[model samples]
Target: MTAADAASLVPAAAAGRPGTEFRHGLVVGKFYPPHAGHHALIAAAAARCAVVTVVVAPARRESIPLELRLDWLREAHGVTPWVRFVGVYDDHPVDYDDPAVWDLHCAVFRAALGGARVDAVFSSEAYGDELARRFDAVAVCVDPERRTVPVSGTAVRADPAGHWTHLHAAVRAWFVRRVVVVGAESTGTTTMAAALAARLGTVWVPEYGRELTARKLARLRLDRPDATVFDVTWDRDDFVEVVREQQAAEDRAARSSGPLLVCDTDARATAVWEERYLGSASAEVRAAARRPALYLLTDHVGVPFDDDGLRDGRHLRAWMTVRFRAELAGSGVPVVELTGPHERRLAEAVAACEDLLAVGWGLADPLLPVEG
Candidate 1:
């Protein structure tokens, strides 16, 4: 392909035109740390589509670096020819939220592969319907069960092992042999999350603030009322310092080839909590949350109110859960939940991942032709 062709980043086409190709799918995600669920979904998409276009966002400072994420995709997953990885340009003088983002950004694609003819868009998201209507194609939801699996980058970042056991394999592999676990108090969030991590052959990031803070400042009694210049800032600073340490630790864990890096707390969720407890977050805390493959959330099912360590009542948990859902919902990332029966939830997460992968990538030609 020529430079122009490569720049266009077109999807592979069949022998057709305005009629649109019957195969070829597009799956877009951050794939921060591609996990098992992502792998399953991509595999499913690959089976259904001839070509899969994977659109990735370059990593920001707070998030896992882009270079590392790309390496994982290229080295870990191998460069999938059918799968074209394109990064959306935020610096471009275009509004990402605008409806024209696709028209403007996908132009290069259209320029190169207009003749390719796209017939369908695959996804498990409600927006899939809109994409189909907008693209004037069949928007397919590949989840055989049509059920939504609850997982989020935030949740997993909090406690990978606790709640991320069921994350897509593609995601787990990308990050490392680690599972992130996020949940409220008294959930034995640490204990259970660790157990799951051991089973998955993944490293684990214990709760940084709880452990690190406890080690350093937790003893100083930095109560909300004391509000001493020394105590308050010291504790927050300790927490921040712990975050940096954890960030380095998580990055180091991601660098190796073992089990997934089950993070104890993602920078994003941690930032959220910092604001909740500390009144407001420093610029530094807010910037640390951009990394993580996916967030896995623990549901209200088994979680109960607890005050063990820096935790509030179930009300706070519920609020945080809602916040997690809302923040991640629009982030174009995937979230999986570990609620319901263990086996059923796991199966559902896997299936959702398969559907997501299929939707995100045109990894392979459909085993069968599209029905007219």
Candidate 2:
């Protein structure tokens, strides 16, 4: 490609356009987690040269896996003929302060390419210049100030949900895991969920059934003016619709939720509710209970039950607690039964959530303890 053709590939850099006259180019990074910025840098390189090779070199002990990161690049640019993705899985020095870091990475890069002619190096970091010089190619910097995409992996990791707009869909799936809190009424499910989300600095999915029921009651009151509440009298259709809507709300929230989704109630709990009041539950509602999630079963505290005119008295509340245990029995789902005062329950719930993220989601140190 000529210099002018290569220049067109540079995406409005503040330093004007760097020379991209070359037959082949290479873009290199640890790409700890490929963000939109990484995609732009690689695309810029591909547009400037006849062919471009992108390398993902991950060091030891990263929170995310090397293969997963490599897959992100491939999924993003695998269709293009000019764009090639390669991965370097080694324990090489990641810090530039290490004297041999450059040479070590250079050897790995050349080995991965198998002596292919590289006429240019594309990157958004200052080290791009040295990497290019090592390969006898010119360095074309694309967004040193992060003006194009304007995000770093560190920021994304710190608050994935806050930066949801910048993450690739594939990466979002890895970060999204659900932690549903389910129990009988007045067991502090909603209270614990709110506290956990606040402590973790993430979003929470509220119980849609409560809102739906409130609306239904309002509609009923318009006709039967004497009707003040509706509980065990709810029909099978009511329970089924609640279960479906609960799942829908959860699905929508998970798309934008951060590394962890704190759910006040889930489809499984909805089924338990269905079986409790309706005398019979639908197969579809039971099927929805099969989703894999970290379940936190809240035990009833000795606190007074605040009957919101919707609860079926204290007797049924106690019965429903037993029903929850029976329904979850032999289900093979991971369970953490929480019992104690609200403050102690919140602490236990937070630890359970952190453990769930670390073990189930493969996140190393997923949640940092919140300070007062």
Candidate 3:
């Protein structure tokens, strides 16, 4: 079945009639990286209970943050007045047969619930009955065999790309590999970013700085009709604004991107532009720089400078390229310099991205129950 079909089966809280079978239902899980199956389980609980409290209890060592998991759940489910999400650190070891360990975990859950009474314990695990017994609640197991939505936190952690369809937009944003193309003027940064995105079947974020520059020059020419690109002025605030808008654009695109996201430039590259114009980079702009998965630097060696009405950096291209290399050296992110022609550059970029994807996301495993 299609993803939409699967989503349609998971009843929204508004569509569910107020069930008299339970008052306050409790759904607990590590939710290390919540997937479609987890949402299905929660929807089942929300449909039957007057109020459902989802306790996001993940161990400390898990790669995905507890708070981020809670945010994704809340975002995915939308405004459900009766459904509440809470998170707590459950660092206790997992042992189903050990009463002491169960008690420790229960104490953590109880603290998160604020001592609220649970009428039903909703889960998809074998220990649901025991968890309900401890809470003096009824055990409501949903899709214990994984027939409804075949996914798990462990499976998602192991291979996010394999189960991309099972993830929500917010969760996908967190896992999306950001590949930024940054370079000197007339070096085909925009061309490479767009071409790579098209080749990979993903979205590309245009350079916000270029748009802002055009706007600045347009506004400048209102009084001086003969004004040129050199007439445009630069300030510390302009670079910061570029960083803000660029980062925001990247974020919006990432939510809907495929496994890979291509960007013409990022905040870090904005810092370089700031230094080029202002002679120094400000702390505000520098602090906003984020590390992406990979960087594709377009070399200006053979590429002829095209004086696009917005560009005045023909002489500074070599200097800017050297500076970008210097800044990215300490970033620790993998950088691939593209030269030769458009086809060769694209081929090199595609190979670099493939290698990065092959590395995979090495998320640490969450604590699992010991089998008898």
TM-score of each: 0.42, 0.61, 0.91
lDDT of 3 by residue, 159-220 (tens): 89889999999999999999999999999999999999999999999999999999999998
lDDT of 2 by residue, 1-372 (tens): 222332333333312324545667888877767888888898888678766777776665678887788787888887665566777665664555554767887898887676676788998987788888889998899999998899877677666656667887777766787788888987888888888889987789898878877787778888886776652257777777887887777767766677788888876788877776667678887776745567888888565688887665477777877877877665677788888788888888888877766554333432221332
Whole-model Cα lDDT per candidate?
0.53, 0.74, 0.88
Total clashing pairs in model 1? 75
Per-residue error at 12 for model 2, in Å? 22
Position 154, candidate 3: lDDT:
79
lDDT of 1 by residue, 76-147 (tens): 345355554545422222333466655654554444333445566666555566655655667767663434
Which residue pairs of candidate 3 clash?
none
Better model by lDDT: candidate 1 vs candidate 2: 2
The candidate, 1 or 3, that scores higher on lDDT is 3
Ranking by TM-score: 3, 2, 1
